[model samples]
Target chain A: MNRDFAIECERLSRIYRSGSIPGRGRETPALTDLTMQVPKAVVFGLLGPNGAGKTTTIRILSTLLAPTSGSARVLGYDVVKQAKQVRERIGFILGGDRGLYGRLTGKQNVRYFGALNRLNPKTAKRRGDELLERVGLAAAADTLVEEYSRGMKQRLHIARGLLTDPEVIFMDEPTIGLDPMGAQELRQYIPELVGQGKTILLTTHYMLEADMLCDEIALIDHGRLVALGTPDEIKRNFSRLTIFEIVVNQTSETLTAELSNIDGVQHVETSAEGIFQKITIAVEAGVDARDQIQATIGAERVESLVVRDPTLEEAYVSILT
Target chain B: MAAALHNIALQAYYSYKGLFLWLNWTAYISNVFIAPVVFVVIVTLTGRFAGQSDSANAYIIGMAAYAIPAILSGGILQSFCYERTFGTLSLIYASRSNRWVTYWSKGLLHYPNGLLAAATSLLFGWLLLDLDFSRLNWPALVVLLLVISFSCLCLCLFVGNFSIALREWIIPVGITNGLLLITSGVVVPVDQLPGFLGEIGRVVPLTHGLSALREAFEGASLGDLVDDIVYELVVGLCYLLAGGFLFSLLEANAKRTGTYESAI
Candidate 1:
């Protein structure tokens, strides 16, 4: 009910019942008592692994799926009761290449979607051209989508999602299959759209993508919200343990056991990479076990040593574990 | 109202582009234009070989009526199936525009195409088979064509709804097409059909529409063929209402079941 929020949900839940015979199948909960709010004109990221209910949440908010219980509102309109209003103000780009007509050209696909949003033919065509150019696909606008590469198709998906000039856009892993350069270029457009005062709800498994693009991040697991804050705030709050990483020419079980016995060292993990061994030690705050670890492992065998703050991925792992 | 119309126009434009503009003209000609003409030719040749002029005439009219479902129903059903497979159905559902407008607009592509197919069949019959039109009641024929088109459109809508509602649409669509071909009195008179099939034939709009068309071709006035025309109109309306109701129920079920996201 907050007018200042672009999206608001209260106890939104979706329970999918399987099997054709009612009451004869198992019930799967895709979302559970989820409550969150996203303020207007900010980039919000829902960071989670696969099957973590991120896509389900996006589908519910986009008005494509109705919640089994509770409610969600987009721009002050109920996603279920006033789906038309919500849909009018929002656009969605789902992951993968399935949504497009492979037979149609990129420009034609954009124009078709624009028309579906009720743009006149001329306006749809003009806007479609503009969007194609904006997405760096103007040169290949006339080519069939089937002929385009995965990266080009992903870019076209972005252009189609923007055809309506929506006030809010839901991008569900838009860069899932893109190359490194392709993903970087696509990421650049997110802030540009936000600069124009549009709210974006992005879902991604890439922690770095979320850290780079999202102004606010909410991490969910098993259909439940686990952590919510800005990137730095999350790293600061959830990351209480210090970490020391050491690369050695060879590591034996004796060396790992010795490091484990060191006072204040909570956990030690090691993995073999080629001829070298990488070891990571998690220790309690205020503990300086670096010198002891170096002495136990023998400084001559140490290939490299570094101590650093926990990254977002490490923070996420810590929270989840 | 303006927005709805715009949506319709744009959807139709895109459907035509996808269906025709993207494909080779030769493919289009072979698929849409030539197939109907070939069917007419085969039927005429068979009828001529049997020395049954009256049967040949009936065959021509029946085949023309058959083209209605063949093109319109098939087109609409294929569009629905492809939308699911192509993953555009969810996108369309997510759009703010009215879903009914989008559905109907995609279907509009079939009308012109069906008309063209039917007309070509009739023209071929006239040129090659020397079919007599001297007794044709022009006004009645026009009315019959309109009624047939409306009835086919209703059937297409019904099939479209059924496709979305059913988890597996292929078997159901195949069965429905098979039933239409078998019981719609396309190849033979409903009266000549054995047992309960004749009774079921009486219920399909194609049966009524084809009956009225044959009557009009035989010089009957619209008033003279009142029963068939009335039956066609009633059947078409029934289909339209039933399809709309079923679509709502199935759509709600899909949301609850979470089947809407999958291509299935």
Candidate 2:
């Protein structure tokens, strides 16, 4: 148990013995031999597709479930052996669907959960009010959660998760069901929380959110971790394969051979779309094929010639596949 | 420990905040007034036809005796079903309140409401039937209600915790309601329930508890009600202990398995 690490899991795995769902039979392993470490105050993103074991990992770390076999520690407390301690250290927000109760007011819901966390009435009330204000729900704090818009409800849920003032927060799809503006609101708020020195572990399949918010990311697919690194680090690793898109003014069959003949040009494909020709060229290692390719294609007919570093989306696809 | 209990109680109070108070009071009022009235009317009609020497007041006492455990069993099981169905039970688990505090507070708070209803109805019934209980066995009646109520609360938690599937909530509520309706000895005395059924009925705390209640209203001494009261207390305690233990075990297992959400 490293004092500086907020979460540590060694060979942690989960096997869900799901009852057959129509077309499938037999138990399936939701997670397999998973291992990860999250340092204190770091915003780590668990990036994965649907059913990619993100929720399973969060649940295990939150002490909501025991692993089938392996160990997990949250804030220096063993998840299985010191579940109550682990629970106390970690605040968990489980998606938008499990938002605050529709009938209770925002303050009321927060106070209710605070009381359950063993806060006295005065302390609970004070904490609840502070959290409501922090989440920007203080103006509508008295209104029933049912009256709150989707974003307000989401903020209230986040407020409820903070009632205990946990050192580590686990958000399993914080902005999944939110509208664009709602997602943007959380996008701004989350980084602020991270700035407050709270370690956050978030899961989302949205590359944009991961890229914008995560300091470090682990990409999981088909229950296996495929990529783990900072966004810039990952982009740098995949930069060696440069993709160039060329739009030509005229269609020419001979252009393929001409582009391929350029130094370091490994692959070229051209497709004609009405009056314009779309060409893709891949440059080989240690190659500066741009000027050579431009000259070969005759720059006057080339409407666009752009070469750039890979986006997280392109990098993710390339790494996962 | 007290703070822990207080926190648990407050959480439970809020969990059932709006509708529970109304529903519980309704269940209480109906149990107190309507149950005994229905029992008295039926008994009086039969007595007139059969020309039996049995007093309507004695029947009222029997019905009131029946109301005590009826309220207990019905109160606990029905609320458990409602919590399970409405997804509130899972919320409680997720919140991390002490399970024992939940069981205790739920039983404690709801039992009073049930007892209030039972007493009000029984008092009304006794007045309507011209009953006098200046020498009633107070200890026996108190013992019966307390023992039975605790047992019912335990049983409800036990069943509710174990049956995690949404559909599983039905079986326990149905079984409990059916058991109380037939074997409660509130409507028909245990002796008239057929030999095998009567023996099973006797083993049920409902039969013995109701009998003790009748004896109490008839001015039976504590000594006279001792055997039956002992039987109710002993069996009810056993059920309470066993049921509570089982419920905690299931709750821990469910948390470990991450099935709390699916179960609720």
Candidate 3:
């Protein structure tokens, strides 16, 4: 384990056995032996589809559930043996827009959790004010939390997470229920926290959010890490071929066969819209198929062409499966 | 220690504040006033209808006098029960506050309010029911109420052990409240029961409590029932100590087994 690593795990796993009935016994494994590390002072995104064990990992790290086997640590403290210390070092905001006291004012709710973190009354009060201001909730400080919109509540939840000034924070789907504007506000705050040297562990399904905010990502599937690296790195490494779409004359079949026969042409497909056909051809970057394609199909047959780098979604779809 | 106490108290207050916003304060506020008044009124109504040997005023005073203990018992137990059932028990057990500090703060919260309600009930009964306290035994009365309250407070400490281990509080709440009412002789005098049932009542904390209450206002001195009063006090103390030890044992087991959160 790196000494500077903010989090480390060695074959961490969890198996939630079903409670035994009078005559039957059964069990299910929620997490496999997954090993990964999150370095200090950076945003590490845990990306996965729903039911892919992303939340389970967060739950174990947060000390909300005991791991069935192996070991894990957050901020150098053993999750089980030093839960109190770990709790002090890491604040968690769970997904699904829960974790708020809807009846209390936002300021009061923050103070309550601050108290739970053992902050002094005066200090808790001060932290509450500072956090409210930090999250742009100062104006709605005294208003009941129930009255706040979903976006506002999410902002308050983020503010609550910062109340303890933890060294590392976990945000699970922080923008799950927010509109574009609310997501924009939360997205804007991530960089500021990163600038302050706070190590953030964020989990989100939105690839754009991950690509925009996270310095690194570990893509999880079926309780396994399928890919792990920087966003750009994953996209570059997974993108085997560049795709080009050509709108040509309806008789583009002859051109398709010739393009397929080219040295680096990997695959070709076409869609017909009435009499016109839009042909898509993928070729390896090192070889040029344009000459062969135009030579066989003719200049008139090739009306227009578009070539672009692969998107993160395309890369993810190609790698995960 | 003070830091922990302040934190726990603030957290409890915030929970109550949250409850208030949801119109859930009925349960808490009733502990201070409504429950105690009900006890006093029940005793008074029973006394009038039955024309019992004791004056209606005396019955009211006796019942009202036990209000402090009743309130303490009701407050601690009710608070524990409600918090546990509502999924907020985590607020107490996992709190940054020390166990003893949290225990005492919760125990003391009901005393002042309970005593006030008791005093008010007694004043009302004395003025309207024409009961005489001129011959009342003040020292005996004070000791009786204190002992009774202490017993219930001790019971609270024990009930808390179960609450911590098993968060489904309905069973504990129903059992505790029902046991207190039946055994305390609050509804019917213990002497009226026959044989073993009556014998069981004699050993109950409420029997001793009610006996002391009646004796005090009837001008009976501590010297008159010295042995019984002493016995009740000793039994109450034993329950307190024994319950505390058992609670500590259960709490240790709960933490180790990681069963506290799964109890509900």
Candidate 4:
């Protein structure tokens, strides 16, 4: 394992076998020979759709689950062989509101987990107080966890995950069930943790969140790594087609066909809203279709036109599809 | 080593904290005292109707022994089941602290609760019934309670292993409670049971422990009950070892199967 990489997995494969009775099950592979490395102190995002093995990868790296055949090392410690050492240096928060004790206060939950990580009593208490404050949960520290809102509970989860002051943190869909403002608030803490030299492996299905937070991203599909790069690099490399969105007072098959026939235009799709027709055209790289698009649709019928680079979502869709 | 000890202590603290802090006093009293007292009264009354005073005294002692499993099986079931249901089992498993140590800490914390319930039942039996306590061997009774509590905890651990593996605690705990009640010589003497079941009862820790308690109540010393005490200890240790092995196996299987990620 390289010391510079916070996490390194070599051909990791996890196959789950299922059957009602023992020795009579079919095997389903969740991860297939997936090899990747995450550099230290980077906010690494594992972006994928649901059931894309992102959580499986996080679980294996964090020592909650063992890979079926391959090896994974976190911070120079083998996840399987040196699992306790790996656990000592790492922490994780899974998505949802079920991890905390409903009967215990928010502070009590943090302190209990701190103790589980073997922190001394005084240190655990101090760290719990600091983390609760940092996560905007100090005000609700003494409230029973069951009474806290989903966002408050999620913040408490974050505080508990950080109680150990781990060098590497794993967050699996941390903002999965939060409101827009809650998600925005949680996003602000990622950079702070990364700023403190902690390597964060975050898994999310939200392409926009990944784009905003990740320094490096790995796009996974069907248990395989499809693309890996910085957000801008991925947008530039995977997407070679620019998008043109046009709003017209009226549109029909003739206009769409005419736009499709324009030079360098690969495909033209049209949809009719209540009072306006919208046209999205994909054009080849280095080709400008502004003049042709305007001429084909007629300048008088056009209400608005916009030309821009493909977004990360468009890039993700293009690569996956 | 110190950290491990600290972890255990903290686990116990948190486990007990939840119980004491959240559970209402009325609920706690009803659960710990009412059920055991009612059961002892019913058994002693039935024995008295049969005009078997000796059997009545035996029934009272057996009912006191029954409290160990009554409190422990539920406590153990909750300890394992609640974690999975609450989604904290994976977090606990991922921590640096040893899983076995954490589980044992919870078990050890519940031990005193089980003893308290057992004592309540015994005290009620003495007060409600005209049972003779003047000849009771105090040290021998203490030893018997200790042995019975440890043995029941081991049995609970064994049941807890299966509960995690199956991802269902209610059924396993229920079956265990039924089997122990019918076969552990609590309401019926082991010698009077059917041949195979009586043999099974002899192997159960409660049978030996209850027999030892009866001997102590009848003025037998620790030396007189050495054989039964030894048997109880041996059985308790075996259950503990087997439970530990099963817990490891199920945990490894859960990891390999990805069941840890699934909700119970």
Candidate 5:
């Protein structure tokens, strides 16, 4: 119940019962007893593998779904009991093109959603125009949504979600189908939305997108919170090892054994790429075991060697695996 | 308050104009404009083929009255059905707009559309059926058309409650249409219909309303037919209220089940 937190959930959980059979069916749990909070005026990213409950959490907080157990509050209003208040203060840009009215013109679609949020006609018109322009859809405002491409439809979804000028915006894969330029522009717009004193909770599969946009990222797996921290903190804390990627003509157990036996070598993984066998070695933070490993492999078998810091994507994979 | 009214107007207009596939010019022309005329033709031609050309006027009157269910019911049903298909119903449910206002206003445009189609059928009846226009009480018949059209709209609103919850409109709409055909005295007399159908005919829209319509066409006064018109109106309102109640109940259930993201 912290007032500073824009979004708060206490052991929020949801189970979907499949009523496929007459009296009995399997139950699927989309979210566990997950408690999390996002502060105001920042981009909070939820990163997870598929079916990790990111969308379910968004749906609950946005007042689109109710928790089977526990509770969630957005902007200090209960998502279930005070849904009207919550819906009035929040907006959501859910992924996929199916949510929009395909037969309506872009402007009409905006106007329709504005009306649903009870936006006054004149204000809706002005704000709809502003949002459509901001989303790069002003020119196509008069065009039927069915005629628009997948990217254009997505942009319209953004415009519709912003029509109410919500305090907390939940975006589920906002840039999923956008072109590179559109995606880049949308990413740039995220912080600008935050700058307007709005809290944004977004879910995306792009590690770089989360790294670049999220002030704090929460990674969930199998309906549970797995990791939560700033991008740099996660990358640094989760993995304090420099990685060495070595290419060889081929690798044998002897080479792997020798590399693993080297002092300060933390972990070694092998995979084949193209015609060459690649050996990825994780080394301890303060240990320079590179010369010993390369010497053990010998110069004749060593095709190439590259050293680099761990990326957010690499850290994410390490923690998840 | 004004904004809420605006929401209703916008939702009603956009639902009929954008959400329904009948907005497409070709579909509109073929389905809305052409279909009613075809229905009238089939009934009149059937009467002629049965060597009962004298019964053509009654058949045309019965058939013309049918535009209420055919036009208004379908129109109102689509307001609920297409919203689910487009995944916008869930969006509306998640919003702060008044659900009662949104639900009832869905048939605003459709009621008038049904009346227009009914009038057109009447005009076609006068032109094609060699019917007597002199016997028709224009004022009383106008009231009858309006009442029956609204009643049918309400009936569809009732059916729409399930059209959305079940995520299948075709079956419900088709069954409703078939029931009206057999039980609403569109082509058969209500009393002449078999036992259960006769009872059903009394409860549905056109049976009572159409009886009054035929009387009004024969120059019966509106005051005398008030009982029948009232019965029709009461039946319609009952359906509408039931629909509204069921809609609220389903919404709560959907929230609990978490199926509002799409129709279940």
Candidate 6:
């Protein structure tokens, strides 16, 4: 309930139960003793794989689901007792086409959500028109939404989410079905919303997107927080592991086995690059076995080699796995 | 107060428009317009064949009145349950809308459509059955029909909310429509059933309204039909209150169980 925090949860947990019989029914724990705080204005990414409690957490913060235990607050309001207050200060966009009405025109869909958010007629119209233009949908605004492309539908969803001009926004898989260009445009849009001092909590499965967009990230797996930090900081956690990228005209099992036998080497992956084969070697930080690897492979066969730090994605995989 | 009413009105209009699969053009026309005529003609002719020609007018009036529930049962259910199908119902639950306003609006515009269906049914009755409307009190019949169709809407929402909360979506509407058809003096008089069923019919909407319609058609004055009119209105009011209670109750259960987010 801290005023400084736009979104806060203390030991928030949720367990979903099925079937009519209470004790006899099966229980699935979706979130377990999770705790985090999001500051007033930043894109806070909830990074996770699938079935990793990301949606459950987002739904709880959005006031769409009640926690089985613990507590969550949005803008200093308790989610259960002050749900209306939370709802008033927040707008959320779901990932796919499910939440929108297919028969309504894009403007009509926007107006409907605007009204749901209790916007007056003038404000709803003005803002709806503005957002449609912002999302590059003004030309198609009058068309029925079902006739729009998937990317267009996603843009309409974004317009609806911003209709309320909320203080905190929650988006689940916001770029789920967008094309590369569409996703890139949305990536630019996220920062502008944050620049307006609105806190955004977005769940994402894309490691690169999280690295590029998030001000702070909390990585979760199996309903627990596995890691939390800036992209650089998280990647620095695995800085002690160095990656060696090698290219050669050819590669064989003998070379791979020889590379594996190196004292501090961890993994060797090989893939084709046109007529050449690219070999990647991950080894411990201090073990700079450049000579041993070069001598083992014969210097004439080794075309080139480069050493670099593990990327955010590689660090994420190493930490989680 | 004004804003709340606006929300209700917008919700009513948009929900009805949004929930339509449009029913396909021909299917909707036949169901709402053509089928009522066939129902009235067949039932009225059957009464004549049974040597009960005296019941022909009664059958025509009952079948016409039935057009409201027939349309509303599907109409109300579609609008009420549509959010779940599209996975958008949770959007309202998650928003800053008043519970009463949101749920009440789901049943709002539907009854107006019910009134139109009943009119079509009666128009067919007037044309095909040669049912006489010369002495019928037109104003009194319109008013009674409005109240009766509204009451049927209240009853439909009541059953839809309570049963959907229990995860029974389709069955309750089916059962309620059949029960009303049998017990509301449609096709057969309620008094012909068991004593308890007759008492049941006395309170359900449309039973008393249809009775008043009969008296009005027989040249009875509006003042003389006050007893049936009052009883019909009272039944409607009761269902209206009950439907609100059940909707609030359904919302509470859904929130507690954390099942309010999606229809699936």
Q: Considering every candidate listed, which one attains the maximal TM-score?
A: 6
The predicted structure with the larger TM-score, 2 or 4, is: 4
lDDT per residue (tens digit) for residues A101-127 in model 4: 888889888878977878987889898
| Top candidate when judged by lDDT against the true structure | 5
* Residue-wise C-alpha lDDT for candidate 1, range A95-155, written one tens digit per residue: 7878988888898899788877887767788888998998789999999999999888888
- Candidate 4 lDDT, B28-83, residue by residue in tens: 67867888888888989999898887687888888888988887887777777677
The residue pairs in collision within model 5 are: none
TM-score of 1: 0.89
Interface RMSD for each of the candidates: 2.7, 3.6, 4.7, 2.6, 2.4, 2.2
Q: Decide which is better by lDDT, 4 or 5.
A: 5
Q: What's the candidate order when arranged by decreasing lDDT?
A: 5, 4, 6, 1, 3, 2
Candidate 6 stretches with Cα past 4 Å from truth are A238-241, A247-253, A261-264, A272-277, A284-305, B1-6, B162-170
Q: What lDDT is obtained when candidate 3 is compared to the true structure?
A: 0.70
Error of 2 at B5 (Å): 4.7
For B91-209, candidate 2 gives per-residue lDDT tens digits of: 45655666666654555555665566557656776566556667776776676666555554555545544444343544665676466557757656777887877776765555666
The better candidate by DockQ, 3 or 6, is: 6
Note the residue pairs that clash in candidate 1: none
What DockQ, between 0 and 1, does each candidate earn? 0.55, 0.33, 0.28, 0.57, 0.62, 0.57
Restricting to chain A, the TM-score for each candidate equals 0.88, 0.82, 0.83, 0.88, 0.85, 0.91
CAPRI verdict on model 4?
A: medium
Model 2 per-residue lDDT at A313:
70
lDDT of 3 by residue, B216-260 (tens): 777889888676677777766776667667654654544433344
Off by over 4 Å in 5: A20-23, A239-242, A245-280, A283-294, A297-309, B51-54
Candidate 3 CAPRI classification by DockQ: acceptable
Please provide, for model 6 over A1-321, each residue's C-alpha lDDT reduced to its tens digit, 9 standing for 90 to 100. Answer: 589999888899988898898679988898998999988999999987888899889888877778988999999999888988999999887788788888888998888777676777678889999999998999999898889888898898889888999999988888989899989999999999999999999887888898899998888888988877777777766445778888998677789999999988888888998888998888877887888888777788878889877877777777777
Q: How do the residues A196-263 of candidate 3 rate in per-residue lDDT, one tens digit apiece?
A: 88888999978899889999888887777778888887777665667778787656336667778888
